[model samples]
Target: MGMGVMRIPRSAFIWISLFFITLILANYGKLVADAISMNWLVKYPKVWVFPLKDYVSLAMQWLVEDATFGLFTFTEATRGLSWVIEQPYNFVRALLSEGFERGLGKSAVQVLPPLSWLTVLSAVIALGHYAKDWTLAAIVGACFGYLAIFGQWDSAMITLASVVIAVPIGVGGGLLFGILAYRHHWFGRLLKPALDLMQTIPIFAYLVPILFMFGFGPVSALVATVIYAMPPMVRITTMALQSVDPEITDFGLICGCTQSQMTWRILIPSALGSLMVGVNQVIMLSLNMVIIASMIGAGGLGFDVLASLRRLDIGGGFEAGIAIVIMAIAIDRLSQAFAERSTSYVHPKIRNRIYHRHPRSMIVLTVLIFSMVVGFFIPMYQHYPESHTITTGAFWDDSIKYLNINYFDQFEAVKIFFLKSFMLPTKRFFIGIPWPWMTCLLVFIGWTFGGWKLALMNGLMTLFIVTNGMWAKAMITVYLCGVSVVIASVIGIPLGILAAVNKRAGKIIGAVIDTLQTLPSFVYLIPVVMLFRIGDFTAMIAIVLYALAPAVRYAAHGIRSVSSELIEAGIVSGCTPTQILTQIRLPLALPNILLGINQTIMLALSMLVITALVGTRDLGQEVYIALTRADTGHGIIAGLSIAFIAIIADRVISASAKNARIRYGLETTHGH
Candidate 1:
């Protein structure tokens, strides 16, 4: 038998494909819907199902029972570890915000004196001065003062205590892992995928296992934050250490330096700049995860935001959100300023200045003494007066009400158009595809972009989703992420280009991007829900806003990173600005732009779990439902599905970037 096919133009083929899909959906819509809605087709057969949830529950029950029966001392071990971890957190928290408490019994406990709020404020100011300059000191003082004035001082301090505990753990573990990966080829290969998985997985995913193992509280939250924040630290550390000049290592060896001495004295000092960037990343990630951590009983400003959202108290939520933003800005600026200062060369004269000559210890001591004396005389120095506290919650609440009432029709129109015209159809198309066909399509694209390895990886991931009975939900997730990314790119790329070409525009746009990036991802849902109401569109809007920063940032970075020599060459060749950008800049920037796209997808996926609260029937909703119901099996699987999708994209995009670099002769022996 002979098979023959008619040739079709590329455009015609695309049109024909769309027509075929529409026809199938129209004709067999109910059947397709039923197949997706029913579990039998996608779910594992009863015999094949593993019952992981029951196993985990049973194991936990047995462990607890054993501990209680003294058959094992699991509880004692956990208690000891918990106590060790809690001590520093509690101490710092009390000093900064809680104030010390001492008593004979719970009912009779009396608050004892602790370090004054003014002392804490002065210490921050001093640290800021030591880290950067007087400007940063002012910023730090102002940020802390705002918290005290807004009556969020305690909540902010609780959050800060967690951060202080978590960042060091994250940075330390990351450095260890990074060094190991850098030293051993096999370990590096093994570590890369794990880091990618960790980085791409949503923070919420980390909370489930932590909650189960540690139970719910600040300890669990700290563990989750560390896990969530560590990958970047590791990747950055490895890259920084690996990027050190070979000549420097040879010189250290020639000087008879041992490995430990070389690492401590030479390697660390030389790589300090890159490592500082990693530190900044760790700090930011820890802050960002604080809110998600709150969901699992980690109380702080994050809890403030979460509680407000639950109560639909927009004013309160906004205030808490502002407090968070202020804290983020303070930390970010201080870290960045310090990083920059460390890399800079200071004049000897300036370095010898009285304040500069002394170590940070002297400055800290001076501030502490002053604060103590002031606190002894002034009661308000110990704590901001409650009567003097200010709030903007009411203003925010009123503003939101006014906007919702005044713009109801406009919001409704946008919601309806987006849902009917873009979201639903795209979602339907993805969900309607046969599981086998979807798997084949993914494999084909992966192979085309990255060869057999990626194809196999993606195929396995797709299989996992299909067998887990989450294909439909995964499709919905894909639809939401895909739409959000497309819209973000549409808005972000052009702005990035504009920013890249103009210095003034870059500064202005960079500030906006920074604000957006630092704002808690959860805060994005509030304003969108206020306008669009609860639905996929609102969720998409939140995801887009949360995800847009990277798109704009990377695009601008990519464009700017293009060699100035190339731009000059274009100019010398009589190329117009448009022609130069199209013919030269964009080509060079494509790899970075693609990276931005990859990041946007990852961010969008991360936001998925949070957006679940706003009503979206996807894998995010599955995870959220599992969390609420304490169904570990379902949440873990659903979260893994999201991770799998992200991994697949990351692999393909990375492969493509590598190929592009090779083609452009920009590939290097060492890469981050």
Candidate 2:
């Protein structure tokens, strides 16, 4: 399609064919070895001829021997860390115990009573009702009630606690780093690349290094979750703070405000809107990590979902999924309300009375009464002397056993059929193509769409995959992720446009998008795999389900953000609502819709690393294998390759989006 590319003769196909033939002949033995290596028969024979069992045992022995030595080395190095934390833990313990007799009235080692289920539900309903309107109140109440009834209340509470801890830490760290990045030119420059790497690294990659350093538990999970969730907030905060009006700063200076006061009172308050968006992002991402974090011993709904997945228990997984969704919705709405609350108009007279009313006293009085009632009445809420109180033992274990016995019986047949008919056939079709032929096709398509930059990127990415001996696996991954993205955009765009056109419907859809975007991917993966089985189709469905949210959100935002004057012009021209939407609105919102497509691609890529839970032979599978075997070299290379693909796509889409935005005179970034 390009002038330079068009001049090349199609007759070069003969030379291309011959070149591949010669290359294949030259590397026939290597190719045969690789093919044989990957074969289930050659790599894992039935204990004979190859002595597969003996070989596997020997490999396991080698791995365990190395792992034991590594552990011993680490233990020696960190021997003092245990002592350091013990000193602090003991110091606080002694102080609390000493003060207990002097009316502090608390023992450091003793467990306190938890609020009753009824009390907790009542408080949540009250808070939700107070936050927004009656609809929100009902949604909040129903969500928690369902969680409680489904036997996920305790795990849900643990997840809530972790989120509560992580969010504030993420927010604080983000704000600090944001201010640092904003104030120092060199620091910001250094931070940009680090942020890029952090943003693109797979969640599993974080697990290895984190577990290496912090070991596996809630703390390591917290560390990983915070790292992942904090970046967007940092970037947003820096951008928002940098975008603050110069005149406002001058005015604040003239008002006799110190630099610190100006930052606290003027800049931060003025930038609150965008900052709140960052906060919302943090909360949502934290919730997304809940299930992934479970891999590292962060117990909650995430663990339950994982357990259900391993056992193929679709119903149990569905329940946990619902709990995750409910939590996501509640937290998202709360953040949204907080962001909106600052803008609410307060009557001057009522504001003064409300401010003078000593709200803390009322809060303290309510807490005391609630505590008294809960401590006295609820059996399960009282501090238990033994292991049994409220329990979910049979509910979880029986579900797993039932599914293992009966559920996968029918599904396995279908899975085998699909694998034989569709999956294997498609894979062979792609792998049968000569590399040179594939290269030409890629170059031609890339040139047609995005021109030379894309062509160059395509060439480089293809070369990388081929050199790494993963070209076929990469193609399979591309096919699945591509299909998912296309499907998401198909559904999400029109739905978003429709939502944007109606105020009430926009509210309802907006809530759905919020919930979907935040719920953990593993929650969706189980039933998807159960329904479709563990192959490309199930993975694509899972990715599509999550990827659709960004597409819907951006399309809605783009349509709603369109200038009203354009609509009026269309109306004056005697255009119907349908004509306006088709002719005026869509054309105007094209750039933003393209942005939504970009987001869909990124979201789909994120899911690539996750779909490995259902087992794909993609880069994600390699990454997982590397973690299990502690093969850091292979893992890093595979991880970077995935990141390279993402970066290429991200750069192309972002460039195109920027071009469209500039052409349409649209603002690229929003300020507070």
Candidate 3:
């Protein structure tokens, strides 16, 4: 293909190829030996390796020293500034343990005991009916009833409580940060990288740091969960607030409202709808963190799920997974109902008690609160505030031990066989390709799909990875994620379109997709391993499953959101349903489909770290190893490698989608 005005010379490309070839040959032996070790170095036995190690060590030490210095400064300066006070970190830990014990202990007695599971089911059903209708009520009640009968009520509650605490904290922090970002441009600029890292850094990669700083317990888990969950809120809040109507603010000011009044009464209320979505996200993400946090000693359903997997008890693990899905659905539906509810003022009617009273929703909420309070004061309900209600560490430990003896050997044997026969060969095939040749292939593919700008962007991304000594691992990640994205696109696009074509299917599929998107993918990993066994195939399968949601969701949305007039136009042309869908709907939705594919790729890569649990020598594994060993140098490099890939994909896809949108006149080109 011919180059654009900005293209590099053919000679430059040739020299670049020669340089990469020489670099590869220099590192060829070591690269092939471990395949993964090359990720840390451009070539082996190089003088730079020692310096890199030292640099990483020095950086970690400095971080530790700095943290220690800050802690000491605060403690010495303030009377109440110990780790508990200065850290106040211990406060959350204590609340999770001693606090829960005292409260639950007291409640256990006075709280009317376990009420028949039927009673609980009835209450949920009533709640659903009151909130929406019979259909929603049925779902809510059935999910709760399933949890109770399946013997997961306590674990589910434990998980719920942590989420109850973490969601508010994350939402509050995110809102605060977001408001700060909006009011101060420099602050937003400064926060951009921190937020990017928080959003893009794999969850597992940060667990080690969280464990190091807070130590293993509920508090560390809470902290990590909050950190992971907070970024989206911050980004959303800022975006939502920025999008608020200026005209409404002007009206508020015209009515003699003060700055604060305008902000609170007008800006905040208007932004409330979008802000609620952010809150929903916070809750979903916080719940999802339960399983991963379990890895570091936070117990609840997540720990149970992990425990079941370790024991190779698919039935038990699957049950725990279902409970998570149920909890996610219940919370999601409740939050969404409130978010979508319309608000209107009504004058009191003549003499009806209901007309004179507050809204029925408020009344119902009050009753629930009153019930909990009444339940709280019974002899069984009071707590001394120092006891934690439940512990799962021993349960998990025993389960792990039993599984190790019974199932681990078989797991290992299968893993070895798969790796030797299938996975290793596939991996080697990709690794055998010369770096320069691969670069050309990627650029060519990008150019064919979009244009030269995309090609250039893709080429530069590959160049960065190769130069940073991350080419091999990057390629491995690419290989697996590549297959997954292709599969996910195939499945998600069709499902999305089908759902879009039918109302009932849309609601059901939308709900399922929502549940899958919000529930932690880690919980699904163990079951996947049991069914498929661990290898690139297993990892790819997991990726495809986890990553499919975006494609389906975006495709459904893209089709459904199409202007009715356009569809009518196709109809007016006497186009058949199939012809309209193919020539108009699909073509128009292509941009969104491409965008979905982009997200699928990013999500697949996010799973890279989690898939390490199944044993893959990818960038995620490197990050995990770095975290385990506290190798900051290696960790930073690996983390950046993932970030770079995500950014590259994001840029190219975003550009292509934008191009499509403009070409189709769905949007205008801003600069041009």
lDDT of each: 0.84, 0.71, 0.72
- TM-score of predicted structure 3: 0.75
Candidate 3, 1-672: lDDT as tens digits: 897688889957866875676456444634564676553333223332334535655765655445345447322332222243223443343333223232454464221233333434556676777567788888887788667656776677667667877888899899899988987889999998798778777877666655555556776787788999999999988898899888887788789998668667877788888888998899888887888888777788999888877776666676687789888888788677656652323365666566345454554455455544655574222221224223333564466566666887776777677568756665665666666666776787578555887788778867756766777788787767776788789889999999999989888988878767866687667656765566677787688788989999889888887888999999999999999899899989988988999899889988888787788788988887887786666776777678777866776787778889988898886834
> In what order do the candidates fall by lDDT, top score first?
1, 3, 2
Candidate 3 local lDDT, residue 342: 29
Q: Name the 10 consecutive residues with the lowest summed lDDT in model 2.
A: 93-102
lDDT per residue, candidate 1, 566-605, as tens digits?
9999999999999999999988898888899999999999
- Using lDDT as the measure, which candidate wins? 1
Q: At residue 431, what lDDT does model 1 achieve?
A: 71
Per-prediction tally of clashes: 0, 0, 11
In candidate 2, the residue pairs with backbone N, CA or C atoms under 3 Å apart (3 or more residues apart, or in different chains) clash, namely none
lDDT of 1 at 179: 83
Give the local distance difference test score of model 3: 0.72
lDDT of 2 at 170: 92
The local lDDT score (0 to 100) that residue 280 gets in candidate 1 is: 93
User: Sorted by TM-score, highest first, which candidate order results?
Assistant: 1, 3, 2
